[model samples]
Every structure is written in C-alpha cells, then in structure tokens.
Target: MILIVASLCVQILCAIHVIRSSRNQIWLLFIMLFSLLGCFAYLMLEVLPQHWNNRHVRTARAQVVGKVDPERAVRDAQRNLDLAETAANYIALGDAQAIRHRYADAESAYRKALAMGPGGDWGTQVKMAGVLFERGESAEALRLLDAAPELGMGSERDRRALLRARILADLGRAAEARLLFEDVIERIAGEEARCHYVAFLLQQGDRYRARSILEEVERRAKRMDLTQRAAQADMYRWAGEQLAELRKV
Candidate 1:
C-alpha cells in the first residue's frame, strides 16, 4: 500500500511538470488519465528540449529590433513626391474597386495610399475612409473622417464631412448625421449635397422636407446649361432612386 501511494505521488508530480511545460490540452488529459506512463511519455517526447535557448534567441531579437511604426513609414513615403503620386493613383483605382464591391482590393489600395502619408491630401484620406466604411470598418472610417477638420480648407473637408455623415447614418446615428448634412449643405451649396440631404430627410420619414429640397434642387439645375445640368440631373436621378428604394422597404 505504501509503495502504491509513493508511485501515485511520483506520477502526480510528473503530471504537474508536464502540464506546466506544454500547452497541449490533449497531452494534459492523457497524463491525467494514465498518470505514470502518460507523464513519462509526455516528458520524453512532448516537452521540448532546448526551449530556453529558443526563448533567449527570441528575446535577443526583440531587444535588437523594436515594434514597427506604420506612421513613420508613411512619413518617409510622403517625403518622396513620386511615391505619393503613385499612392494617389492607387487611391483612384480603389474608388473604382469600391464601386464594384471589391472591398478587399479597395481596402488594400486605400491602405497603401495611407501608408504613403498623403498628408494634407484630404481627398485621398476621405477616399480611404470611404473604402474602410464599405469594408465594414465604419468605426475606423469615422476616426479618419473626424481627423479631416485638422487637414485644412477646401473641397476635401466638405467631402470628408459628407462621407462621415453618411457613415453615421448607416450606424443609425440619424439625428447627428442630419445635423452634419445640414451643416454641409450650408457650407457648400451644391446639387449633390442637396440630394444627399434630401435623401437623408426622406430616410428619416421627413417626406415633406425632402420633397421641398428636391424641388429647389431641380429649379436650380434647370437654369444651368447641358454640362452642368447633366451633372445636376444625375444627382436628382440618384436621389430619386434612393427614394424609390426606401419606399419599397
């Protein structure tokens, strides 16, 4: 009886050692089931010899090289105009990809441009945010859009605000998005913004306001020539489509 108890105690110690040494759950379970033989087999075959040496190598490498900074790399790319231009082309292609719902490719292209540090280039940044939003990274898109105000003045800011508002609407923050759309309309009076704002109001069930806005946009577009009117007509057509689709739902 004493010998049996001693063997059991030895087996328990070996099992504990095996559990500590390896992360394999199956091995641990086996050791628990047939303690003596299982523990011995695990020690001999599973517990890695020279594990400390491997850990030392990894530690030494980490000491020599620290974490990579993506933003720093982007800054370096920004210093080279040629690279930045190439990144711009990539962003354009990304827009095309996004229209086709090729979200992965769109994301890859946008990230490449972002990595090029398109600093002060709000257009590229907004395009990147659009790709991110389409790819279901709406939170990150919002962050990028929110950073747009710091970039500078121009159409980029307007476009970024519009994109951000659209994302906010998608996330069901309609009230906040409506305020943003209204602000955008006030800052930049354009057929596109009017259309988007009207569509947004329509989505929120403000049909009367939406119709009023659409009528105003139509009246403004009618005073323009073929080229400008065609562009404005496109906005009205898109707005009409949005309204039709919403009603179907």
Candidate 2:
C-alpha cells in the first residue's frame, strides 16, 4: 500500500514537472502509462541534466536503465554490429548478450572477435573464457585463464581472479579456490568478493566462517544508502537464505 501510494505520488510530481517546465508532452504520457519507471526516466534524464551533473548520478542512471530495459542494450549492440561488422562491435554485442545470460550468443560473438586476428586480442580471450565458464566449459575456461599474460592490478585483474576462483571451485580444487578467494578479498572493496567467499566457505562446510563473513557483509551494508543496498540486494538475499539454511542444521 505504501509503495503504491509513493509510486502514484512520484508519477504525479513528474507529470506536473513536464507541464510546468514545458518539457516534451511525451514524457507526461510515459509517466501516466509506465508508472515508476517513467518517473525514473524523467528524473534521471530530464531533471538531473537540468539541475545536476554528478558523476554518481550518471552511473546510477545507466545502471537503472540496464536493470529496467536490459534488452535495449542487446538490441543497440546488435544494431551497431549490423551497421559495421567490426571486431569492437562484436565485442560490444557479446558483452550485451552475456549480461542478458545469453551465453551461447556471447560465445559466438567473442569467438568471431577472436578469429579476426587483430581483434583476437588478450582482452577478448579473457572475455571469451568467462562466457565459456558460464556455459559450463570449466576446463576450457581454466585453460584460457592459464594462457593469459599477467594482469597486475585493477578491476580486470580482480574479475579474472574471481572468475578463476569460481572455476577452480567448480573443478573441485577447493584449496586453490580458497587461496584465490582469500587473495582477491583482501584486494577488492565490494560485497561481491565477500559474498563469493561466503558461498565457497559454505560449500566447504565451514558454516561458522561463512556466518562470520556474512555478518561482516551485513555490517558493511548498514553503512550504504538505498541505491548501494539495492545494487547488492541479490547478494544480501542470498546471504539471508544461507543463514536460514545454516540454522536448520
């Protein structure tokens, strides 16, 4: 009831803004028809541009759009590839498809990028390896990781390590997986590394340690704003589910 009322309130507010500010009337129709998503569009695209130019807001708006209309990205990427059959375009399409969980399509796209010689770069190799991992080709994924040159630091390094750790875990190399997870958790700041570690710990039957780490996740979450919390909502929900299951035994 409360959420519905808030939704209606926001829609009304955006409609008024569209009229008063002499913005496009199409936005008014959107607010009336699509509800909260419409309001979000107005606020992020129209209102924010006119009032603020914060970096965080821009990122948040992109993430929101991706969440609300994931397929639009895939379509855009596909269209780009259609217009110019370039290696970069294939990569863009592959990434878009991968985010939508279309692993096979992503693999195909990445493979094409690889066969293009110059486009068959190391970065594309890493991305193709990841999609292969998602497709359950764990051994091939590991091979690709093994073949890549050293990535010393940054998000790409962390991502590679994380993917390697998950692959190792799936391959029954628990010791190797644990070491990689421990190494990456110390380097990364986000909830994802910790959450992945917790899952690995639970799989190893170290429920005590898993619970402890999850409690840390909860503690960190308490310091975040609603948007930050929403970004990791699935992780928190999974942590809750794990905690509940742990209690059963």
TM-score: which candidate is best?
2
Can you give the lDDT of residue 42 in candidate 1?
71
Model 1 deviation from native, Cα RMSD in Å? 21.6
Per-residue lDDT of model 1, residues 1-249, tens digit only: 887787688777776775676667787677778767877777667664545346444544433332343233234434453455777666766665665577787778777777886477666667778878887889988887777656466776777778878899888899899989988877775677888787678778888777667766667766765544443455667766755664565
lDDT of 2 by residue, 91-172 (tens): 9999999989999999999988888766439898998899999999999999998899997779889889999999999899
RMSD score of candidate 2 (Å): 7.5
The lDDT values for all models are 0.69, 0.87
lDDT, residue 209, model 1: 76
> Whole-model lDDT for model 2 versus the true structure?
0.87
Best by lDDT: 2
Displacement of residue 103 (Cα, Å) in model 1 is: 4.1
TM-scores, one per candidate: 0.55, 0.76
